[model samples]
Target: MKFLADNKRTLDALNNWVPNPIILSSFFWGAGNVDQRSIDGLLCSLLHQLLKAEPGLGPQLLTRYPEWTDRATYHDWSNKELETALFLAWDLPTRTASLSSLLPAAEAGIQGSMQTMHF
Candidate 1:
């Protein structure tokens, strides 16, 4: 939310950015398109990348929204949500589609970890 407030253009682009069509397709008839676990993992990996991209976002977010910054308040954000804000804080590189395109190491490492876990 802080990221949304701080960076309108990026948020708009993210909103307008068309998602990949295959992501909406189910493996079988009437089944979920993407499994929840895969979704969560992808989100987690993405957020981690976003935070790394914008190290200063967390501090600014906390400062602007102290209620959230204070744990006693509604600081119920999961790592994914927080990291998503960090990602949104970033300016999109020219013709950037996926961060993984620019940093293959991150995606490769994630795939390696998943394979090791057999998940």
Candidate 2:
């Protein structure tokens, strides 16, 4: 949850502060998508900003998580990352209940095998 908290603070600052186009692009890049090149560009832009803001956090984070440089490989993130990204994207709103509410009922007859899998 610390990532989510930090992301929220970052967003709060963004809401009150206007960053350049490059930083804006990075924020959009954090939204998961299939385009590897675009994601890489965004990550680089974010790194640029982080380097300016904290100096050390950028290198520390990148050194610890080098996979972040490769969007194709990094796309399949762990649940924690997904949760953090969702929290960041949605302003840290309570999503557990809403997510459950949004699931289609079994009787809706969706045809995906993954949906029918049993834990």
| Best candidate (score: TM-score) | 1
Candidate 1 displacement at residue 20 in angstroms: 25
Clash count (model 2, backbone only) = 0
Per-residue lDDT of 10 in model 1: 50
- For model 2, residues 18-119, the per-residue Cα lDDT tens digits are 442112222332234533224333333333443454444444544656765554553455434433332332232211111011123222222242233221
TM-score for each of the candidates = 0.31, 0.25
lDDT of 2: 0.34
Candidate lDDT values, in order = 0.38, 0.34
Residue 10 Cα positional deviation in candidate 1, in Å, after optimal superposition: 22
